[model samples]
Target: MMTHPPRPLALGTALMLASQPLWAQETQELAPVLVQERRTVLPSPAAPLHTRTALPVSVAAEQSFTRADIEALRPRDIFDLMETSLGMNITRQGSRINNFSANRGGNVSFLIDGVYLTATQAQRVVGDIPVGAVESIQFIRDGSVLSILPVMGFGSRVSSPTQGVVVINTQPAPGKAAQDRAQIKASYATYDSWSTSGSFRHSWMDGRLQLGGGYQHAASQGKPDWNMAYASDTYMLHGGWKDPDFMAMASVFINKGEREIQRYIGVLPNSSVAVGQLNSATWKYDPRDTQVFTLNLARYWNGQHTTALTYGRGKADGTAWYYATNVNPDTVAGRYFKDESTDLNLSHSIVGEQNSFKVGAQRIGYVQLTETLASAKPAPREEEIYGLYFTDEYRLTPAWAIDASARMDKKHISKGGDKYGADGSTLKLSDDTWTDKAWLLSLGTAWQINPTWRLSGRYAYSRTPTPDSITTSANQELPDERLSRWELGLDAKLHPALQASFTPFYYVIKDAKVVDSSAPKIKVFNADTGSYEALSVYTSAAEVIRKGFELSLKGRFADDMLGYEVGWSHFKDDSVTADSGTVETPKNRYTARLDWRYGPWSSTLSALRVDEYCHYFQGACLPTGDFTTVNLNISRRFEHGIKVSLYGQNLTDKRYYTRHKTGNGQTVYNLSDGALADVGATYGIEIGMDF
Candidate 1:
């Protein structure tokens, strides 16, 4: 172990540090009265670098999820965990995966290691990724248009990706631990579900080189008779080398997951149609397999100059049940998509200066292959995207800072497939490629106001092309989406142990993709009859406007051992059509979490409440009921590096549906007889050992 002497701190730094939440500052505080007392503490087994709780204030309004938060919540999956977090809503349909939206009906995007995950098929598999390998999750509510534009312009449907960005950072290399350390955990829960996972980190050459790996397996008997059953296997490996002038890191991850789905069931038992009841019929399989590899290298020079290169490849293959008028509804089909990208970034800052600048360029390519059946001819599609961006940050004074950025992107899409005529003649689909281009600009400023208060505001504008989806055909083209947003925020330190924030925002998305269930049945030719039959399909509205405000408060007491967080969001999202109908956003939503720790025992109590909203059914708005759920968890740690935990989800045993979106992009009810069908109370216990 090595220790370094503490250096004198500046007055501004001291004031800023004092404004941070007590819970996040506890482990970093040190008092040095004399020269000998200046010795810093070395690495300890209880505190690992990869699990640090440091949260640097950002220009954008942000929320964070740390390892400590995860340990207390014991969520069943990422979606389960995020739903409990601030500013996120996930509703479960009849399948294992759920519908997700953030910031009160704003689009949400996901990224891993700064690499775009949503542009690839990997986005569909995010629900199955093992959280065992995750180090931290950050949700930037007001993303910079420069960063959001290229992603949206390329393929993402979010006209305003700036509204929400979820960045997932996996565990990094081992720290300066003297020897190898490891932990293993096993758990069982209601619904006949179980999981086992293990991870280990080791360092070599005085911590200059490090390696780590983790694996997890989980399975669950979702419902009766194996319906909606689920299972998954995931593995991750990471390696890194660091030195004074250069650093390199590499990581690889693979996931194989399977899920079962139950088709639409009517909300009423004796309604015009019967649906959603547990039946003896076998559930359809929705299998997903994903693999990703990423490498990052950086070079450092004197006087605060650095250059970095990053490259990542991600691929996903899966089978899903799609409604086909000509085939059995229970059948599954295969599809695959792949993404590759490389980026180069350069940044410079003068030593002891208050300004910084950064520039970056990137190129990405994606491929998709789809087939209705194993022997059917495949449809191949490809896209190429190129981007360039620049950002500048300047501190006008000790209490004021401002930033500006700009970005531009170009995307090209092409497809290859056979067009079959009714006379059995084959025609070549147009190989001519189409291209889209977009640019974005943003500006933001933050003022400390005083030692106990801060204020910030931002405005951004961007344009994005229509999103490409599995159902999109070669000839299906739509106009680009345009968006802009302005937000104002206030942060206040009400007390030494309490912190609060209030953010008000407004955004408009033109040509946005809003839920629309009014589309009539479409005709599809059947080979058997050489005739056409009409089948219902989902649809979407072209535009909308969203306005909202978010409030959050957190407090810590009892020497940072007891803490609580409260969050609330109110929004009004409406379509621009003549009807002026409200969009699928909750008018009011609230969340609360309380955490307490005494000696070796810790506990967490959480709750979520959502107000009633409108749902589209049969081309009409229906009242979707409001619901509330409470969850609890308790855990104890022993002296022998062993820990045990017990948790219950929906502890009140309340009956509720997570809410669902149908194939036609319309929100639908998932209840039966005015009660939940499958999502009931669930409980679990876990035991683990650290070495």
Candidate 2:
């Protein structure tokens, strides 16, 4: 058994210092002090770097969360944090693996400081980062053109047509003074889980140059019979320099972890297995490691023009172990894989009197190799992508604006591997290559209806390449997926202390890809077992229509001491096929949060409700019951920068299970018994300090 070290008292002291100006102003005694502070805190006069294009007007729905929000929510993991956003859903398939969907079966694109990441890398890196290390998170629900820049790479595109994007920024804003500070946090929770982290930041030259680093470790011995023990360690280092004309930032992140696949406690209704018997393949990732690096640079040629460049690299290696049924130790197999990716982007922006224009180019490359117990050698797959794009925003008047964007992307893929057949026979595949190109477009407009109201609308068309599973399994190329969407939004200041927004959206997708488990089984050779196995077949649907609406209200009252946020999202999908169905996404979801503060004490309460939805599995639609959960956090802040908090999740101890998408693109439960229940009520206390 592994145990955490002893806890320490939360005690720290912070000192504040102010600098005097070299020259004093005689007009007023405070003028010089104010001027000096502004100069040090404000950004340079040059145009700042634009990682992603920003819309001139609020034509799309977007949600943003600050560090304060994160602290109040007290989320335990990335999945918990993302679930707070509207129209977003997270389902965990393994301890560190998850599926993210937005707006009714639409895939999501993920970015970190404008650096694009593949789907696999996103899951591995983002899930490992400590919540305290994140400075902010933004969710773009309707800006397809602006969000599509990251997916134009050779790396795995969104598995399905994307309806949203999630951007994470880890760098924190510089403070008012050049200072050095550190933070330490630790907590213990149910199931013998423990988490600990430490971080520090140092600034120099009037806060113009800074360096920061952190390390985090977490482990848990899950409930008995679940076999879900997990452990991970993460390290991060970042540095940046800023000046009037030039800026540069670089960061490196590394994570290593291992998790055992969970098991079920009961048998399915139609299964022949014994009653009350635990069932599932015994599987685990013995060891997995991933590393990521990014560099960002910007040159402000003038106040009106700027050039920026961003580069990123990622590497991952892992080994998986599979044991015979009943966890027999004498018989086992291993599968090993390695993946690497590189991405580069360059852009120039021009600011005119009434218009702004941006042009950019990007290149991305990826390589993967895999070896199994029975394979003779490692198989290799490689890809390269090139993209060019342009965007323009014109202001017709101070009260109205219009924006347009266009992009062209091309990708080339080469693959050589051992193809297995029905009777456990292997066929060596030659180097096969394929190339594809696509174009995307978007148009948007906004109008100020009145002093307190605004209206906006946007239309966008996007396309993505078919998934690798379908292409590789079929041993051929396939038609790309395409989608078109329209969204309308209205924002209103209903009261002096309240704001509200309403959005309605519609989407149409062509050649939607899916896996049919009930269809004729495709026989595939299992390298580890040296035997043939039946697997799900992949197919494409002609079309799918999805429509949804979102409503949200946020405000502060009681002299800013009490704040609240409430949101509701509803969506339904219809597939144009008699035997096919889309049921992974719930039709109705509701979320609410309330914050209260009085002097040094504060509390936050949040709730989520998801309506029951059918899951398409094995040609049948099974009902997945609805569930509701509540989380609460209470904290006290001391004058010396010390904070202590108590947090609890699923306070009611409700039991529920979520549907997840499998590697084969099929929707199914996490357990072989058709049920993977959530970990019931858990409580923990955490303490932290800054100096």
Candidate 3:
């Protein structure tokens, strides 16, 4: 191993000291096939990158999440992990189904390398909980935007390709100390359902090459609300090779992921009838099928400069419905939609005076092949997008810095439409193509603020299109989507080991494509549209958030008799200039946790509360609901790496849904009966030995 002396940092050089290794390609003999595997420790614990924590904010927990972060969290499910992260929020209409929608703040966008994973298909967004398959996640704020990534328009959606980027790395380096790792989990909930999975990994070649995979089978949900009760099986495959000049990671993900909820779900208005509600006999969702492939490459220019490239492909197979008799039933019903795409990107980094600049470009194209139940012809629709981007970061001082980026994109939507006469006399679909060329620009600055604080604010403008799954029409909307965002934050060192941070942000979104009418499937073009504001605060020293505030007390309180932490935040949002007044935003939320340890065992109790959030849109207002839940958890760590844990959610078994968005586009009360979850209690045990 070679190590360089600590060098003086330079301006335009904040991005240097990148991962650069000499290609040990084919330098060693082949070894027996091995199991596959999956942060920068901040010099100062308090100075986390961009304060992005969301609400129910705990004033006592200040730790951020990363690939290494999730391992300790032992998240009960994917939803729990995401909700605890900063700058990211996934809204849910009910616990039974996560159909509401998702959004991330500022320039925060999720990615598998440089590819856009969220826009691949319909109802395929909830794929969190990577199962220890995550690599290092690099959170890049609008430092650049690449076409291969998801469209970045205005709205609460995550945009600005990496003003800061969070790249979750699932591959682990090879090493010999005769090292090994294994993870196994089994869980049982109500409805006689259960799930179990296990994964193992071994490292070699100093962690240069790693391979790993996992399989899961869960007792299906036959809950009264569910249409069918069937077991689900999922398998994960991943592999990777790493060296100086060449590095690659590829995966083949096959999961039998499907769910059938009663068509008439959630709290609904009395006016709506169960015309086509999904029931035991009729409700169906073509099991979601997805295949993911990705590759990453690096070419070193010198000891001080390195360039890298990434590529990915994904395909989704499923059947969607026409809720309001919208999607021409014959075209969308019982149809097979194959969303497949290829993404490519190349990035270059160079160490400059006191800083470093990294720039890259990406392009993505998707082919949507559909076969309607009514149409014998399996027509094909192609969507193409390309982007060019660049970013520079200058380090002014060891504790202060600045970064900025710019990008441009061209999008083409090719759909086969019936012939349309140029004059308004005939009503026909035109085969004419629609292409949108847009330029996205953004800039950001990070300040150490002080010895105990760091602050960053960013502004970005982009012209991307809306997602097709949610849009009412195939006709592309060429309008530019513009956005403006501002964030100001403060972090402080209350004591030698105690830290706290507070950030308040403002957002303006416009040119969004939303369903104007459910009947007949009509879309209306609206401009300069919605606006939202958010505030987040984090205070934790513990390695995990769900562990509550115990981590902070030990860090600051130093294992005192009583140690605790509290987090609270406020998020209020609504239409900036629409007839609809303030919509209920779950943003107004708060959380507090207190944990104590009496020798070998520990107990944690947490309280979570959410202010009224927009549940249904009706009348001249958006109806909302409120939620408050309490949870209790207990765990024990024994000698020789053995552990046992137990937890209970909604201890009071509060009869409340997370959020509501009913009324079938009209105003109505909805219970989301299918989602009415019973106050749940869970128990689990783990046994491990480190030899």
Candidate 4:
């Protein structure tokens, strides 16, 4: 494996090109197109309010990317978009594990058109969604109590406000007039990869009713000898109806895929201590499928009060193959896993002259089942969660306002089913039942000092339940994790065309969950070895603190033909116990993006820089150097609604690793991998047409 340090030359070159004045040439203005921009305002069970009214300054600190933005960036996937544009750091445990973490080893929740997905479900579906189907993506960092309502219907490890929430909307916009719209696109890139997608929408009855559907197919042959080939197909269907007093919508999404896991590269030999190694050459996931459905209904009364109801369900099934060694193909084994969940929510809201309030209640049922090739029966785990929440916004004065929210949740979990070893012998099974309760509270205030400047502050506290997967006989009764946070922000209009924001925050977590590798809690049968193996136990840490600040500046120039944005973020961690230190994450990050449009041509350039950090493994911290990468997209529109574009990623060809870890002594090997390093500089061409 090879690694490179940050390249100042690449950063400087990208900035220089962005500053060019080529867009200053005279050009004809194009027809105005209506773009829907909807922001989540209150804790409603239905979809977010479609009104254009802006949120109060105190709780308006959300970041959003529209469909137009996506078209200009041309990210390969959602994960790529988050890392390059949203300033989010992603960590993957391994290719087959499907364990993903963001920020500083924190869990982030996902919501697709008001349907919540659990962490496990998110891992399998987030990356599979067709990029062409996304309408908007929003990042709500304030941990607004309303944002957590979706997750409440589906319990998750995203307990703290610092983890944040990512809301993705895939529903197509309802045009103003009765019409039909359709588009199709195709793209081919490096590594013998290609993709094709098509979508259509039909609206009738004075634009009161709408129907749409989309399909996508993609395949890729990864780097030679890496055994990472992948392929997938996705389908979507949606319908909506709106009237003076009522609105209803429903959608269905399906995805299926298969891929071979990448092989792990060995660790650096400079270390003195010996570490475990794992052999994963024959590891892979074959025949995986996922399906999700959502329905929403809302009613308005007297234009001052509203009631809404939402229902959602999701299901996933997959098979994982593990071989004892690369040479022994005959020693292969398979494990099948299935996940299913359903939720229902009801909410009501009232508007007043000086005060606004919303209340909601929800229930969720989830189940997980797993079985080995030799097992007599599948092992099953089930969870039921119930929650209630309320939010209030009050105007103390024209220049001052206050907001508060509270939520309560209860969860019940049970585990059972038969277990068997490779030798066909019965194994010990734990049939346990447990109940947990948690709550969250938040308060915020905003003051408009003047027309150009606004100040806001907020505080939040919450308790998160432990995940069922990590629970064992030894720690099945562990206490819940507790977290608190404080944040302050200031927004300023520096100029007529420029705006800036600064935010500083402090966060603390107590009784954090951690795996105790040295303490084996239970013995699990290893099919390959035909014997029992001890598994690690879960424990709690005393405390950990994270302090960070974010700064951003964005605006348009050249009469709005050119747009630019710059952002910087920094974070520092303090752990009460060295063994419980935070995961490897950059202490500082810098990002910049420039979008230029001239006549029928449009282009976008973006860059990201990450500071060096250390990875903690086996009680040793190893340094991983910093790096920088740049990406560019340029497109041209032709007559008859035809369009063509060129996309380039990691133009600098900077090589860097996303994660560093030692494997199990016998089978798994040390590994380090990332996007640029996995496939090198990638270039692609895309063509599309609209009718």
For TM-score, the strongest prediction is 2
TM-score of each prediction: 0.80, 0.85, 0.70, 0.83
Candidates arranged by TM-score, highest first: 2, 4, 1, 3
Residue range with the least summed lDDT across 10 consecutive positions in model 2: 36-45
Clash pairs, candidate 4, are 276-665, 277-664, 277-665, 277-668, 278-667, 278-668, 278-669, 279-667, 279-668
How well is each residue in 1-691 modelled by candidate 3, as lDDT tens digits? Answer: 1123444444323233232233532243332333322111112312111111111111111234454344444444554554444333444433124432222223334455335553324225335334445544443222232222444421112222332333443444323212466667665655665667776665568766777777777655564544435445667666677666565666655556665533333344442333223312224455656666667666665665877777778676665333222334343345455667777776776766565566667677667654344344665666566667666556666555566666776655565322212121213332334445666665665565444555655555665544322222233332444555455545555564466656554555565333232223222221111111111111111111000011122133555634455555554444312322213335555555566677777676666565665543333333343666666666677786655666665666555545433323222232232232333443434332323
True lDDT of residue 65, candidate 2: 86
The sequence of per-residue lDDT tens digits that candidate 4 reaches over residues 488-588 is 88887667569988888888889866654445224555654454443435567678787887788999989889999888877776652334323556788
Arranged by lDDT with the best first, the candidates are: 2, 4, 1, 3
Off by over 4 Å in 2: 1-49, 53-56, 147-160, 173-180, 265-268, 272-277, 328-331, 374-376, 416-432, 464-480, 514-519, 523-525, 529-540, 576-578, 581-583, 660-672
* Residue 559 lDDT, candidate 2, scale 0-100: 91
Query: lDDT for each of the candidates?
Result: 0.63, 0.70, 0.45, 0.67
Q: How many clashes in each structure?
A: 4, 0, 80, 9
Off by over 4 Å in 4: 1-57, 96-99, 102-105, 147-162, 173-180, 270-280, 323-333, 374-376, 416-434, 465-478, 514-538, 576-578, 666-677
- How would you encode candidate 2's per-residue C-alpha lDDT over 73-119 as one tens digit per residue? 98878778888789888766553367777865566767776677666
Residue-wise C-alpha lDDT for candidate 1, range 211-319, written one tens digit per residue: 8889999998875643557788999998788776776888888888877664443455443235444332243445677787777776767556766666777777776
Clash pairs (backbone) in predicted model 1: 265-275, 265-276, 266-275, 538-664
334: Cα error in model 3, Å? 4.5
